[model samples]
Target: MGFLPNSMLIMARKPGLVEAFAGLGLAVQGPSALPDEIKRMAAFMASRAAGCVYCQTHTHHQAANAGISADKLEALWDYETSDLFSEAERSALRVAQSAAQVPNAVTGADMSALKQHFSDEQIVDLVAVISLFGFLNRWNDTFATALEEEPSAHAAAHMAAHGWDAGKHAR
Candidate 1:
């Protein structure tokens, strides 16, 4: 048997659910204090480490739109050995990987890198983005939510049509 009945699933797909997703989208997109590329990179690294295919796809396209190269994206699979990443990207990935594996595994080196590269405010937002996606990864994994479509496309269209900070949108 599946996790939930079809009727309940349908109810979960109602307008209120859509609104909640919209809120999350806005929250992720509303980090005006941080560069959009860095935020997307952080989210992508966290999602990759968490093994959330949905988020991986979403953040991959988001990275692409933010001017990340395909080679760099592919190198994310083995970021440690790849030359495609910058010091900042590598540092953030270290944080995400350590956070994913063991909470305190993010060491002094990681902290130093973060401090060197990102502002305090940006670090706060970065951590929040990581934490949020960690939660999302678990939730989506638990529910076995099939990532059938790329959310980045949806987000792009929404931003293009309405603007980046638009009030409401879909998942």
Candidate 2:
């Protein structure tokens, strides 16, 4: 977050991919009915389920920037039983987790649960957040994108407690 990420720096070799993602990133991350914090949470969960340490750290930084509490982030992977999350948050996170699976594990019951808490537009936005991270997770992990300082430090301080490490993405 402090400087250009290695992924973007490398992606620039093919400028068209960067241009395409610029618009898509804005569209997916831009303001909507969905709160930034929840979007960040979904992204963190998606990136984690995808095993992208680079994105996991980035989303951790963004989640903190968006005011997600350490308590919630600490309990993220265990949200199903975490008191820090409400049923609504749990539903969205469930979708993110399921959607991150290779075979796309989302079920009818998952959609129904999401519908109970989010409007149609919000659901789309939530899916978009998860979908966006799907792309980002693959990009960073595939490239072994080096961790940026701010996020790397943050992940070290806050995220390592949850068993995160830079691993192959280490700077």
Candidate 3:
């Protein structure tokens, strides 16, 4: 990595915390049966729902790298009504949004809908992606981590039209 994120630098003050957090993050995001695009999309949506500008921009960049179309990414907040997403994608995004809510609003119907399209393992992966972003959302928001340049530029070019703002999180 050229420059470590501010969040990673802060976590580095406690090496064990950095190791454990990075390990879990790698494990959750590394090779898996779950398609990378879906995982990235879920992570992106979770970050959006959490209102973490740092994470939303980071995941949006990652999702673009993973080949998620700008159309799909832009339409994500309207996933339920958009034809850009498959039923499976919609289900997974719904799970991510619901689970990312402050009170953990995920419902049985959400799980049921997910089961209609994804295996238990895939469901676990979805939850893992959402849960990872939950940690990241809180970490970034609480630390007020400065937005890295690349993500900042990407957000301005691609996300500002969607109402994303750097706000207090801007470097």
lDDT of each: 0.65, 0.90, 0.90
Residue-level lDDT tens digits of model 1 in 48-155: 678665565566666776787666756676777788777877787888777765444788889899889888887787777788778766766556554333454543
Residue 29, model 1, lDDT: 63
Per-model TM-score on C-alpha atoms: 0.69, 0.96, 0.96
The number of residue pairs in model 3 that clash at the backbone is 0
Inter-residue clash pairs, candidate 2: none
What stretches of model 2 exceed 4 Å from their correct place? none
On residues 95-133, what C-alpha lDDT tens digit does candidate 3 reach at each position? Answer: 899899989888999899999999999999989999999
Candidate 2 Cα deviation (angstroms), residue 55:
0.5
Q: What is the lDDT of residue 78 in candidate 1?
A: 73
State the local distance difference test value for candidate 1. Answer: 0.65
Better of 1 and 2 by TM-score: 2
Error of 2 at 53 (Å): 0.6
For candidate 2, lDDT tens digit of each residue in 1-171? 457878888889999999999899999999999878789999998988888899889988888877888888888979999999999999999999999989999999999999999999999999999999999999988999998888898889998877888999887
Model 3 TM-score, 2 decimals: 0.96
Rate residue 137 of model 2 by lDDT.
92
